[model samples]
Target: MAFPRSTCLLLLLASFLLTPLEGHTFNVMDYGAIGNGRTDDSEAFMKAWSDVCKASASPTFLVPGDRRFLINPVVFEGRCRSKKIKFKVDGTITAPSEPSKWKCINKQCHSWISFKHVDGLVISGSGTIDGNAEKWWKQGRVTGARPNALVVARSNNVQLHDLSFKDNPHMHVVFHHCDGVKISHISIDAPEDSPNTDGIHLKETASVIIEHCTIGTGDDCISLVDGSTHIDMRHIKCGPGHGISIGSLGKFGLSETVEYIHVKDAQFTGTTNGVRIKTWQGGRGHARNMIFEKIRSSDSEYPIIIDQFYCDHTECHDKPNAVEIRNISYIDVKGTSKKETAVKIACSDTVPCRDIFIQNINLIYDQSGKQASAYCKNVINGYYHGVVRPNISCLQNDKLP
Candidate 1:
């Protein structure tokens, strides 16, 4: 008996255009952020990431939990308006423990928390990003150029999980040119003589999916340089790091490229190199389809390397076109080698190393009964199947020049 009045304002504008529109947290202590671990919350996290990147719904940028901010070289910019931006971080994100209180940005000191051009980003909670890098590692590892602790540039579908990284003044979480990334259960620690502390690095990233990580760094617990491709790592737990590398790629000679990499169920203890692939000498391109399966190496030290003459110094000269390694595989790698060789395929005497595959390798020699060996130079098309224990004999005669 009382309808009219423009039919009750057209039923309240169709119930406010079918509801659903509230999700824009943006709390960095309400934009003035005084989480206190020595103050500088970087302009309250860039004004709460500018209202969580201008929120258009799926927003959230919080940083709550047991406080400890103090960030300095920040950057969090993005072409956002929210396509799912959640960066929660339960709290603790230090850095700037002196190397002159570190702050460079344009004059370089590269990354101390940068996530530019984000897309569908989602960094998880139970945080801890620390990097109070012990005075930049006593300042002098080539003058400690420092600063790399979280940098996800040109992002795509990124998603990092349950974070925790520490004492890193160099590489600890870097994913450049990202696309479809997903890092899981993260945990990285430094100080095994922390210098380049790389825990999880990847350049020109694509379709990445790292899982259950637990890295202990001093370098590469997982590094895939140059245009990294479809990478997939599993249950990793590397140690005093250096295991898991794929190219010190095409360095002074550029033209690099890394291919579909897959590492499985990894676990390396005192690592120094357990599954490597360091390229150097006048680089060219191509690090083909790779896979290092079910690896478990304790007391590692070159438990299976493929150094394309990766000279870290001594005025590296000998250049003759390297970086062409082909379809590589090393399945079920079991080990305990503090070095008695333990499989070192130093390929590239003019780009050698084609199909190189080795099956169930069991390396020994961690003292108690010495026995572990296998070293091949310029690997020329190798392939050995089934039980290969200290017996790679140049990959068993699959010779191809």
Candidate 2:
């Protein structure tokens, strides 16, 4: 009843001809130890990187241990793309207090670690990259030229794991114009008082996943800026920072449509706010299909918020910025806060915020709840439960002076 071998040749060939996966393995070595927590091991780190992730070599890179490393931001130029570029750092990479004194990539961004115009690079380590950012952060109060810890730009298929990056003068990690990024099992810590020290800044990216991470800083644990889509975050712990956020968008002539995003199984402690979606009245874009589920918070500000007229600065921008936010659902969110209200929904006038839903949220907003000062148009189908008050008080309760 079956065909003979020669007769079924084409079918057999088809079965054997599935698309093969092209991937490479590389390694890096800091030539640095992990215990001391202070050393300049970047040069050796670069040497280890050069040995492994060469132009024609395998993609995965490993970083071995047993020494001290003081490294500056390694410079990577040109359009570098291969199966994958992996950095296995089992040691420590230390950033100097003065970045200018350290080895720099292009002199534009002072990062302890950086990559530019790369494709499919996976940077992971069971070790630590120490920013030691307190002095720099304190100096930034006067200079205001603080630098980020890790910077990746114009890349794709990026993965970071088993890594601890901390003490950033500015943002701890930044992904710019990079798509397909994944961050897992990473820990970031900075002073809760540091300014602009965001945990992760994902800008102009598509299809990003942040999971199993613990972040504590001064700004948003995750800040999604202009031109991002398909972002998924889960199983995260954040504290003393702005919670996971979407937009202060549409300021730079950008109109992003964020969808298919989910944030769940997250816990927050003593953060300024919990979950927020903020947009300016001047941005022109649409946001749909966002879900926040199974998130818990304690001693937090606004547990849920949607601010369409969001501008923290006075001279905001001169753009036709507006956003259409709809079809957003926040379910199974429980939190205990002493704020005035648990939810705040402030939309824009030209384009309203509608179809926002909240169910099974057990938020405890006391009279001391915080609210946003930014005001805009009214929202439709905006729902809430266990929230005290809104549209009356700005974010004065948690406002820092």
Clash count, one per candidate: 0, 35
Quality of model 2 by C-alpha lDDT: 0.71
Return the lDDT, model 2, position 141.
Answer: 56
* Candidate 1: stretches off by over 4 Å: 1-25, 39-57, 62-85, 88-92, 95-121, 124-128, 131-158, 161-192, 195-216, 223-241, 245-271, 274-342, 345-394, 399-401
The list of candidate 2 runs beyond 4 A from truth reads: 1-40, 55-60, 78-82, 103-106, 141-144, 252-257, 314-321, 366-377, 383-401
lDDT of 1: 0.86
Residue-by-residue lDDT tens digits, candidate 2, 1-401: 99898879978777656523234343333344233436555555556555444444335555556644566667654364345566677776677777446555455545557787767677887777777677776556565356678889888888888898878768888998888999999999988888888898887788899999999998999888767778899999999898888877765556666666789898888887788888776677777789999989887777777887678887765344487898888778776764655666777665767766665556655434443222324666655443323332322222223
Models, CA RMSD each: 16.8, 8.5
lDDT of each: 0.86, 0.71
List pairs with backbone clashes in candidate 1. Answer: none
Distance from true position, residue 344, model 1, in Å?
A: 3.9
Model 2 Cα shift for residue 368 (angstroms):
11
